[model samples]
Target chain A: MSVPTSTPELLRASVEQFYARHMQLLDDGDAEAWAETFTEDGLFALPGRPEPTRGRAALAEGARRAHTERLASHETHRHWHGMLDIRPQDDGSVHVRCYALVVATPRGGEPRLHRSCVCRDVLVPAGSQWQVRSRRVTRDGF
Target chain B: MSVPTSTPELLRASVEQFYARHMQLLDDGDAEAWAETFTEDGLFALPGRPEPTRGRAALAEGARRAHTERLASHETHRHWHGMLDIRPQDDGSVHVRCYALVVATPRGGEPRLHRSCVCRDVLVPAGSQWQVRSRRVTRDGF
Candidate 1:
């Protein structure tokens, strides 16, 4: 694993951009593209889950199964990810922390706050882009 | 307004230690000490609040009135802050993102998850230590 040679500001910008792209893919329901945001062995786990969804294929399947089922067929999903704190580690993996607010709205109905969560991600640079090595999400208990 | 002379790793350790102390003081109901963790003009605000509670005096009063209210009269309160992401700013201040879990245990009742929130904080160096410049907490709508 090569160490990050980029300046802190540049590193932060890359992580932020990765997050923006990830959120867009997820909110757009492009599960395949969303999965591409992670490494092949990446895992997405929620609290109380015995095991995380490992591998890109599994990650995509989990997203669709979890959100698409609850989402109204007539509605679209929206996700807001902000309050980012990006830290670069010695091994070159960048740690990311942000809050994600998932909302659903029907064509004419009101938008609803479906889930509010804090997500931590370990992103490893792959070529010119970064891929999530692991993503652990904890939903708000309230 | 000095740039943080410390490296990213060292800065992270400092911020982590600060958060640990902050949580301990708040959980211990040491409002005075907790308030000292902020700058003289520090502001703590929540969503839906018109204005932030500013200044040391006001910050302490708010902490006591909010958390200490349930401390001994009704039940004990515990706050857990975790998943912290610390970022060094250009101006030497640091940006912090973390998840805070508040649990309530009635004198004889079961422990319950009271509230879950995502907090964003801007911490500036004051003398030898870091002080919170501002903190904005957003609660989960769910």
Candidate 2:
């Protein structure tokens, strides 16, 4: 596969592709694979939560629980991310901020916007790809 | 401003910036400004529509009519584009295909997924920026 030559180009392209897969894994309820996109000691935090979910194991468990809830509700969720602002840090890590909207469609109903949130992540190069070192999500209006 | 040196990188960056402004103008209900992002003889087509809207004047009028309807409904629409696939053509134009979702929030109600669609565009260089030469949208499940 061809790769972007410059640092900014490379980082932007990597981040876009990373989210395409990451969001898909989440929507597909592949909790373990989704968590694997993060570092072994990745941190997932929310704005109002005092404690964050640390480590890939914890992240996977969290996602699994959410997936179970979604399954029980008979709703399929799709995460759409856009308006990405990617900045490459001096330490080779990239800081990305974007708007994410979760659309949930019930088994036989119209789709609704479940959540509108701002997602920020610190991504570090993991071999040829990138792994999320830390992620913080802030929901809109709260 | 620092620009990417390579052609691919430059095209990618230009496309991203172009959509950033283009979508914002549409959402803000700036019909004329939004239409100006297209070329003078731009074409807008839809899947089932027999005739496409041609020329900047017609595009602006169509956008204005939509804006009027949106105002009457007391709903605000936000266009979120993601998963962009950008390709540079041999003739200096760029082809961009992306998934675009419209989220509409009523005056006093929760937000809903207004529409899910695939947007494809042909963009050409307009001095230092890019303008849409032609656009086609295909609605999901239709």
Candidate 3:
């Protein structure tokens, strides 16, 4: 296993790139593709909600379902992320806290802020890339 | 006014220390004290919410009311943060992102996972310290 050191600069860049890719994949409507951003034992859940879907396969399925059930079109939503806290873990993984503003732009309706989620992500090194091991999404209000 | 162009390490450390202190103040039941983390012109708001209070005075008032009206105590709220995205802005300030989780413990009840809010903070240099000029809170859930 590659020992992860505190390269704050690199980690900073990694997060920016990760958010960028997330938006791109989401816009592409490729749930499966987006799911690949996680590790095999990855989890995705609404933070503080009690449970999360475990493993990459389940996460992929969850993403697919969420996309189909909630979003009408990829163009309907856009997001901006701001970091609040970050720390590297002992196992060469990184823990992140971020706030996101998701805006929904329906066909003719004025852009509405859908939700703000405090996301907690655990990222691990996968091959030459950093893949998310888990994500807990928390939403405060509509 | 002090020049904000410090070393990268200093900038990063300042950010980390600022958050550590911020969390400490909140945990200490000093909401007004927490609000003091910002500068005179600081603007505070919770993202996705329409109403935002500007300036340190307003921010302090808002914090006081929220702490009182919510009738809640963060006495047991624990904050964990990670995933930092930091960029030095053109205006001699910094824009950053991080993910956070806040767990609250209530009296005679299971430890409740409180709202996880993203702290979007913009900092400007004040002497050797960085003070927040603006802050936006993006909460994940109740």
Which candidate number would show the highest DockQ if scored against the true structure? 2
Top candidate on lDDT is 2
Q: Residues A1-142, candidate 3: write the lDDT tens digits.
A: 2323445545555655777897667655587877788887888787455688888677777767766754655446666665445677777888877666566777767775455556788888776567888888866431
Candidate 3 lDDT tens digits, B18-94: 67557655644577777778887778777666777777778777766755644454234445556667788878889
Q: B68-104, model 2: which lDDT tens digit per residue?
A: 9988988777788888998877787778899988877
DockQ of candidate 1 is 0.03
- Tens digit per residue, CA lDDT, model 2, A108-137: 998878776768899888777788999999
Error of 1 at A1 (Å): 12
Residue A92 displacement (Å), model 3:
1.7
Q: lDDT scores for all predictions?
A: 0.75, 0.82, 0.66
Q: Report the C-alpha displacement of residue A128, candidate 3, in angstroms.
A: 3.4
What's the best-to-worst order under lDDT?
A: 2, 1, 3
Question: What is the C-alpha DockQ of each candidate?
Answer: 0.03, 0.21, 0.09
Model 1: lDDT to the true structure: 0.75
| Deviation (Å) of A125 in candidate 1 | 6.3
